[model samples]
Target chain A: MTLLAQYALTGVVTGCFLILATIGFSLTRQVEGFLNIAHAEMLGVSAFITWGLNAVAGWPFLPSAAVAVVATAFLGLAIGRVVYDPMRRLGPAVLLITSVGVAYVMAGVMHAIIGTGIRSLDMPLATSYKAFGLRITDYQMVVVALAAATGISLALFLNRTKTGLAIRAMSSNPELAASRGIDVRQTSRATWLIASGLAGLAGVMLALIATLSTDIAFNQILQILAVAILAGLGSLYSVIAAGLIVGIAMDMSVYWIPAGYRPLIAFLVVILALLVRPQGLSGKARS
Target chain B: MNLVQLFLAVVMFGSLFSVLTLSLNLQYARGGMINFGTVAYFAAGAYAYAIVTQEPPSGLDQYLVGLHGPWWAGFLAAGVASMAFAVLTGWPTLRLRGEYLALTTFAFAEMLHSLLVNERRIGNGTVGLANVERPDPGSLGLPDAWAYAGAAFLLMLATALVFRRLLASPYGRAIDAVRDDETAAEAIGKDIARLRFEVFVISAVPIGFAGALYAMITTLVSPDLFTAEVTFFVWIALVLGGERTILGAVLGTMALVGFQELVRAFPFESVRAAEIAAAGEDIVTGILFILILRWQPFEAMVKRRAAA
Candidate 1:
């Protein structure tokens, strides 16, 4: 029972960051209808940026995270403008390929800049709270709370805001939405910024949780994809649920499998989800 | 090694990749299947070959499958193992279309990678299988490089001949029909799913052979040897050389690998030079991929026009 409780705690903590990583991908899928392979780099960008600021430059954590988030938001905006916007005329395949190319560039640029080594966020140690055989750190609690807050606010934004409504309308039917006077360009750019900013925040949180490395993006990318697909790629609420399930599943897999096989759980879930529920938990069936 | 040996090594590596590229070309260019999980079969073949040829580990070195066999038998085992893997995984995954199918394949490849890296009993927990036997050509009075290059070239030629015959056959036409228009092909009674499954499985054979050859040439096999980057490398080569053309695979591998070697040969005397060399190829390839996406080749244009 104690072991299960510990696993559950760790699973929830891991799930918080998984939610953060996948929400952006889900949002983009809803609006853009293509997998942004480059979005995987947004995490690395923010993590490295915050690492540079807090660890290298001796700046405090909040300011570094804020700047990193803004930087990543702009990075997404630039990719949308420079690469995606122009090539979208070609087709989704071209756009998908371009996103992959963008990912390669991001990986190359990260390699060129940092030169490959694990770098941790330079923060003081946090006190832990233990209850019911689970030990939780202050940082881990903060991560979960932040994710909850982000998820709630995102729900509010999508359900209550006029811009969010326009975004959804555009996603569902671009022609009809455009006819109804929704500015496609503005909405897309905003979606990019919001999603990218969320991805950046996830990266910052992840760097705090673990050591930052160039491989972080590559390592997390598959899991992020799995989460995105499991959530049906467009359902924000289901993304949170799917993230938690995958995280818990990964943690619980250690009981039956070796610790190294933890990553395989996500892939298995992905394949199963693709075969059984390609539309995801709450996603509408494809026409 | 001298420049000659270095170039010969490049040639051998190029030939190995040529086989891989041909497989990809056959699948994507001719068969219309976007397989992003090429590493799965390739790694399977390598591990199978290693298992067949390698001696059982005695002390600290332990791994799955250690049965000594002839090199030819190893190659055959590799091909068969790869085909079996394809059959197992492709049944459910082949039902998906376009990006979903590609993503599933990518997932499968990553799963295999994770398994290989994690399961110590499988590939020794990322330490990898080592000391794979390399056939010596000295008995035949041939330089090792020349002999290896000849073998690799011969394998590539055989692959191409088989590929060409398949393309010329009715099966190839059916695959093209599915690629061009799946619904139309189905309407015309082309059994799209079965065709895709067949191509997906058949293409794995050469890739399997390529993987076995790679293990033999390098004399080692590691999880790192079969990353998704290998898929991207082949994809870039195929796109750059023009898909569906006979010499596209060979030309594409030569160009990409040749440029990489040239960058490696740059006169620089620092660790940063090496980094630059590596990153330079990646950044250039990324840019080239973008450019290709913007303005695809004439062959693609023709295909699109015909489809329209």
Candidate 2:
């Protein structure tokens, strides 16, 4: 019983991080109507920036994280303007391929800059508190709290703020929203900035938990996609729920299954979801 | 330089890519399905041939039991395997459009790659298979290069002929109808799912067959050969030549491959320079796709051909 509790606790901790990562993917898809395949690259750039500030410039954690988020957000907006805007002017297929190209370019640049080495941050691991004979880390608890706070704030912003409402309206019908005097382009830029900032925060949290590497960002991106798809593209709540479920499933699978087979489970689940309810759990059915 | 050797190499490389582009064109041009999983079939065929022809001559292999067959049998087996996979994947995924279908297929290809990399019990893992015997030319008493080139050209001719016939057939008309308007095709009594599955299988077969031939020529089969880069290269060929046109696919592949070889032969200052220049081929191809898509070069081609 204690062993199971420990596993569940660990699962919830990792799930919190995944929920943060997936929010950007979910929000971007809702606003842009296209999956940002280069999103993982954005996370990677942020992590690298964090590493640079902490290691090279000898900056402290909070300040470095702030700088990293701002830099990554700007980078994401630039990528949106340069690559995605031109791609949007073209057909959907062209845009999709362009996104793939951007992903490739970003991966290549990251590899070139970082030299494919794995690095770790020097942050202290959060202390653990025993509960019902199970150990739960303070860092884990903080992660959960942070994720919940972000989710609540985002929900409120969407419902209360004019800009957030404009984003939702643009997501539903861009043309109609533009006709109603919403600055569609400005909303898209804001979505890109906020989505990328969230991704940067997720990257910092992920780095603290695991060894930072270039490929880590892409793996997180794939996990984010799985969550967004499982939740149905536009449902923020479902996306968070799906991320938690998948994160727990992945962590639990490591206990019973060989590590080699864990990726197979995710692939199988995504393929099955695609075959059955491609619109996802909360998605509206398209004719 | 002997014109024959250069010509044979060109034809051989051209035929391989032509097979790739043709399969891609079938799905993209005829069915309007953006299949990024073409390499899945190609890898299936190559690995099928490698396993069937060159499995370690020991123990009863359960997962791929009868895989150690002759070259012809291996080719046929690859086609059958790829077609089976296509039928299974395409039936459900064909319902998606544009980016969704592309991402789904791309994910499937990545999964297939992961399986190949991880599943050593059947596939020999990343180390792959090697030293498989090539088809004999000595029995026919011809020069090896000429014989291999001739065989490849013959395969290309046969594929081209079949593709031409299919495009001109009633089945081809149905494929185009589905591509143009899936809802309209369903309204007119066309079974959209069945047609999609059929075209997908047909397209996959050639890709698998080409993979078998590639394995035979290279005398090696590894997972690296079937990466998304390869699929993207085929896309470049299809877009450059003109999607949905068989001749365009053939011409585009030949032009692109020939250009790459020419660039490689140039005396760059360093090997890094050469490698960078080679990577530039992709950049150029991508730019060309954008330009051609915007300009619709095929329309001009149609006008020019009509004038002629």
Candidate 3:
């Protein structure tokens, strides 16, 4: 029973990281009207930036993570302004395919720079805390706390801010949002920054909790897609439920099946969810 | 590498992968479905071919099944296996539209890949199945490389001709009608879902055959070789060729393959240099993909010719 609880605790941490990773991707789908395939590479970008600043440049962890997040936000903004802005009129399919190109470029650049190897930060090793035979690491706790913080902050931002409302309006209907005094360009740009920044934050969590590799970001996309799809693509609040569901399902399955199937479990749960509820946990579907 | 060898390599791989690009064309252009899980079918075919022709498991072999059949029988099984897998995956997911469909298919493919990697009984786990059997071209008094290249070319030609013929027929018109406008097509008595499911299944057969040919050329089957990368590569080719034309699709595959071959042929001084070159290849391919998509020169060319 304790083992199961431990697994569930770990699953919650995994779920938190997944939420951080997927919120940006879901946001991009909502506002930009396309699935940005390159979005996960932004995680790779931020993770590596943090690694480079902390390990290679001998900086402390918090400052390195902060700089990495900010830099990643700006990088995403530039990519949006340069590559995606002109192609906004080309329809979602074209933009989706083009983002694959962007991913290839980003991944290639990382491979050239980092080469191939598993890397870790220069920070202290994770301190494990135990209660009632359940164990959790400091980094894992940070991930959970940060996920809650980001989730609450994002919810507040979306509901309470002027720009946030504009983003929401633009996502639901672009032409109407534009005609109703929303700055289409600014909203789009803001989505990119926030989405990419979120990805950066997730990348930091990933680095803290796991090893880093150039190809690690690619692997995250599968789970992120699973959560996003299970959340019904555009809905934000439902991502919380969907992420925890997928994460717990994947981790808990290890008790019964081999650990190698963890990733497979996430997809299985998603495929089953999709089959039963095509619009996902949310009752709305993206048209 | 020698220029002639490079050309043969390109022709060989280009034709083999063109089979994938052609099927993707049919699915995306005519069927209006974005199948992001194409590698699954290809992997299915390859694994089927490998298992069927492989000798029954002996010492050190962990896989559960090996039919010990002839190459021809295995090749046929490959097609059947691919189509079967497609039916299984497509039946449930086809009702979902657009990116949803894409994601489902992709999820299914990843699931398959994970299974293959984890289940040693499937293909000896990550070690995969090696020493796959193939018919000998030397027995027919032909060079092995040239024979496989010719076979790939013939397969590609057959796929292209059949698709062209299909698209020219009334059935093709119905498929197009569905893509152009679903409601109007349904209003005119077309079974939209059935058409899409059929197209999805039909296009899968050629990919399976291509996968068998790919296994024969390489004489190996592994989870690593069949990844999402192959799916992306085919999509890039489909986009590069302007989506709807057979000739354009073939040309795009050939050009892309030729470019990759050239990059690989260049000599490098060190592992780092080779790594950088490979990365450079990716960057250049990505840049080309972006440029082609941004300008859409191929689409423009087709339009100009139509106007003329």
Candidate 4:
């Protein structure tokens, strides 16, 4: 029972981080209709930016995170404008290749700037809290709460706000949305900003839990891709659920299998997911 | 530099890349499968050859089992193993369309990398296998470089001929039909899945063969050789050379690989050119890919060919 509880705790913690990282990808895919391979790199960018501010500039945690989020949001907006806008006119294959290229460029630039060395975030370790005989770190709790809050806010933004509705309209049918005077371009830019900012927040939270490395972005991006696909592309709720499942499964496998075999488990899960639910959990049936 | 030596070197490089590009083009151009795990088969071939010919380590020779197969046997075994793996994975994953399939294969490739890097017992982990013997060219009396280049050229010509025949055959037309529209092909009595699986296996054989040759050429096999970057580079070559054109893949690989070597040789003081050279290959390839896709280079080439 205790072992199960331990696994569950670890799973939830890992799931929380996955959700944070993947929610933005889910949103952006919904808005843009293509997988943004550079999403994980943007997360890395935010984490590094936050680290620099906190470690070098001596800023407090909240202030640094805020600055990183803003910076990432702007960067996301710029990417949407400069890279994606022109490519949107091309076919899906072209866009897919371009996003991959953009991802390579972003990863290269990040590595070049950050010097390719792993860096530890200097945030004070959060105290552990016990709930129902299960130990939970304060950071983990904060991450979960923040993720939930962000998710709820996003739901409200999509369903309630005029601009969010416009974004949804655009995602559903860009041509029709444009005909309805929805300003598809503006909505896309806004979606990029919000989605990438969320990714940044996830990155900061993730870096807090683990050491930051150049390859972290690529690894996390792969995981996020899996999560986004399992969730069926655009369904935000399904993405969260899928993220939780993958995280828990990954954490639980460590107990039963050798550490080296951990990656194979994720690969197995992804392959199985592709075989069983190619369209993902909530994806629309292809015509 | 000796003109003969330089010419031989370029030919060797060109032939090796031609092999890589042919396999890539088979999937990307002919079958419309965006395989990001192309290097997995290549790595598998290299490792297979390495394992078959490897002697036990000095300290553990008594405890661990070792194989001492002929080099030709090892190479053939590598190709066969790679083909088997491709068939196994391609059966299920080929059903997926577009990016999902790409992402899944990419994940599989990464898994292969991790498995190779961590499994010290089976393969030597990250240190990789070394001191494998190269194929002998005894009694040919030609220079060693010329001999190797000659053999590689023959292999490249053989591969090109085989692929051209395959592409022109009825089965090749089936592969193209499946790529164009799976449902339509299915309606027309073609088993889309079966054809895809066939092409997947066929394409993997040459890739694996090339990989085995690569291990022999370099006289080593390491986890680093099977990176996503290598697969990406192959993708770039296939795209730049005009997919579906056998000769184009050969030309494309030569140009891209030559450009990569040139970039590495250039004096760039600002960016750790080695590191950027490592990363820049993908960046340049990606840029070229986007450019070629946008401009439709193949269409223009075809027009010129028609005019000629």
Candidate 5:
């Protein structure tokens, strides 16, 4: 039972990381109507920036993270303006492949520049407290807390803010939103910034628990993609639930399957979800 | 490497990937099936060949099935095995539409890749199957590389001819109809699902052969060799050359492989220059993919078949 409790706690932390990654991915897909594989690359850039400032330059963590987050938000904006905006005229297939190209470019550049070494921040190890016969670390608690804050805040922002409503409107029907005098270009630009900014924060949080590597960032694309697909691609609220399910399943699968096959959990969930409910848990049935 | 060796490398990769690109053309360009799990089929073939042709595991390396067969047998098994895999995965997943199908396939590929890495019994735990048999071009008194390159080129030519023939047949027209409008094709009493499944299975055959040929050329098989990068490389080539025509597949492979070779051949001495060249290739390909789609430069390349 304690083992079960421990695995569940670990699963929540993993799910939190995924929620941060997939929410942005889901939002971008809602607007662009294609799978942007390059969204994962944003995490790589922000993680690298945080590593550079906190580890290399000896700056403190919070300030360095703030700068990295802001920098990556701009990077997202620039990538939106430069790559996605112009490419929007093309069909989704073209955009999908282009996003893949962008992903490869970012990874290749990182490989050439950083040489595939594992880099991590110099944060102190957190003390663990035993409760209910399961040990939980302070860092784990902090991760869950931060993730909850981000998710709730984002939910509020989308519900309350004009930009958020506009984003929601565009997501439902771009042509309809445009017909109603919603500024498609400006909404899209704002969507890109917000999505990429979320991606930046996710990257930092992931780096805190795991080491920073370009491959790690790239590999997470599959898991995030799985979460997005299982959540029906664009439904933000459903994505949070999907992320937790996937994360927990991935961690708990080790009890039955070998630990090395944890990825198989995500794969199975995605394939099964796609097969049974292509519309997803929250998606409306398309005619 | 000398210029001759470099030239041979280009020809080898070009022909090998030409086979892959053509397979993709049949699936996507002709049949309208978006299969993102291509590398899975490719790797399946390579592993099948490796299992059949390799010597028994020695020292630290332990893997399943070392049948130790002739080169032709291994190659045939590669194609058949990949076809079987496609049939298994395609039957259920083919019901999905557009992005859903693509993501499911992508998930399947990633799952297989992980399995290959973790299951040492199947793939030898990332060390991979090595010392697989290679046909001796030495029997003909020609260089080994020349033999490999010549074999790949012949395979490409044969596959391309077969694809061209298929495209010219009523079967080809049926698929084009399905791709253009599935409901209309169904209205005309064509079995859309079965046709798609057949195309999907048939397309896997060449890719499987390409994977075996890749193993034969490199004389090794590893999970790293069959990454998503290989799939995208084929995609970039097909999209760049134009999708509907056979000429596009060949030309795209040549153009893409040629561009990479050009960058490699240039004497960029600085440390950063090499990195820039590497990253620039992807950036250029990305931009080109976007531009070609946005502008539809070769829209007329797709021949209309009496409105199907």
Candidate 6:
């Protein structure tokens, strides 16, 4: 019983991490109106920058993470303006395929720079706290706290600011938003930075909890896609719910099944969600 | 990695992958479906062949079934298996459109991969099935590489001819009509769903045959070899050749495979050098993909030739 409870706790942490990773992807799909396949590679970029600074170059973790996130945000904006802007004349399908090329290029650069090996941030060991036979680590707690903080702040930003209103308007209908005097270029740029910066933040949380290899970020794309789909591809609030549902389902399944089948849980969730509720938990038609 | 060896390798792999690109071309360009899980069908075929032709389980074998059948029977089974998988996946997914279809197919493929890796009763899990039986090409007084290359070419040519014939018919026009405008096709009494399902199943057969040929060429079937990377490579090839033409599909696959072969041909002194070269190849291939898509040089060429 305690084991199940413990698994659930870990699942929530996993769920929180997924939320961070997927928000950026969902944001891109909403505003830019295309799935960015390179979004996962952005996580790799930020994680590696953090790793390079803290582990390889002997900087403290906080400063390294801040720099990595900021750099990743700006980099994503640049790629957007340069690679994706002109291609807007093309449809979403073409843009999706183009992002795969972007992913390949970004992954190659990271591979050339980082090489193949396990890496981690040069930080203190995780301090585990146990109560009532349940355990949580400092880093895991950080992930959960950051997820909540980001979720709240993002909600406030979206609801309370003029730019946030512009973003929302643009995502729902880009032409309508433009005709209403929203700056198309500025909103698009904001979307890229925020989305990419969120990915960067997720990368930091990833470095905190898990051992990193060059391929680790790439490995998460499927799981991230699963979460995104369950959130109805472009919906925001449901990402939290979908993330936890998948994360807990995956972790808790390990109690009854072989550990090797854990990844299968995400896939099963995706298939079922897509089949049963194509519009997903958001219950709103994106089209 | 001599020039002769490189040429043969490109022809062999280019054709095998061309089978996949050709099928994708049918699904995407004509049927208006984006089936991103092409590797799963290919894997289904390979595994079916491996299981059918391998001898019954012996010492240390964890897999549950092996038919000990002949190569021809196994080849037939490969095609049937691929069609079966396509039916299973396509029936549920044909209702979805665009990126949703793409992601569902991708999820299905990953699910199958996990099953193959974790289910020890299926091809001994990650260890995979080796020493898969095949008829010796030497019986025909030909070297193995040359015989296999010829076999791949024959398979590719057959696929192209069949698809070309299918598309040129009235039914093919119906399929095109559906893609060009779904509502108009429906208005004309064309069953959009049925045409899609049929094309989805029919195109899968050649890929299964290609998978069987691939297993014969490599003499092995492993979870490692059938990854999303295979799917991505086929998509890139389709893009390179431009869509909606059999000849373009072939040429594009040949060009992409030849490019990779050229990079691999160079000898290296250290592992680092080799790794860097591989990375460089990825970078260049990606750049080329982006550039080609941006300029659409192949599409432009096709249009110009048509006008002239």
Selected candidate, larger lDDT, 4 vs 5: 5
**Per-candidate DockQ vs. reference:** 0.71, 0.26, 0.84, 0.47, 0.51, 0.79
**C-alpha displacement of B278 in model 1, angstroms?**
2.0
lDDT-based ranking: 3, 6, 1, 5, 4, 2
Model 6, B1-308: lDDT tens digits are: 78889999999999999999999999999889998899999999999999999999999999999999999999999999999999999999898899999989999999999999999998999999999998899999999999999999999999999999999999999999999999999999999999999999999999999999999999999999999989989989999999889999999999999999999999999999888888888888888888878788988998999999
User: Which candidate wins on DockQ?
Assistant: 3
DockQ pick, better of 3 and 5: 3
Clashing pairs in 3: none
Task: Estimate, for each residue in B174-229, the C-alpha lDDT of model 5 and write its tens digit.
Answer: 99999999899999999999999999999899989988998888788988888877
Full-model lDDT, candidate 3: 0.93
For model 3, the superposed segments whose C-alpha errors exceed 4 Å read: none
Would candidate 5 be rated incorrect, acceptable, medium or high by CAPRI criteria?
medium
Task: Residues A177-229, candidate 4: write the lDDT tens digits.
Answer: 99999987778888998999998999889778888887788888778877777
lDDT of 3 by residue, B170-280 (tens): 999999999999999999999999999999999999999999999999998999999999999999988888889999899999999999999999999999999999998
**Residue by residue across A84-149, what tens digits does model 5's lDDT show?**
778786767778877886786677767667655588897887789997888878877777888799
Error of 6 at B123 (Å): 0.8
How does residue A134 of candidate 4 score in lDDT?
83
Clashing pairs in 6: none
- Give Cα-based local distance difference scores for all models: 0.85, 0.77, 0.93, 0.80, 0.85, 0.92
Across residues B69-160, which tens digit of lDDT does each residue of candidate 4 receive? 88898889889979887977787888887777788788888888888887776577777777876667766677667777877788889899
Please tell me what DockQ candidate 2 reaches: 0.26
Give me the TM-scores for chain A across all models, comma-separated.
0.97, 0.94, 0.98, 0.95, 0.97, 0.99
> How well does candidate 6 score on lDDT at residue A160?
95
lDDT tens digits, residues B135-191, model 1? 678999998778888888888899999999998988788888999989999998988
Q: List the residue pairs that clash in candidate 5.
A: none
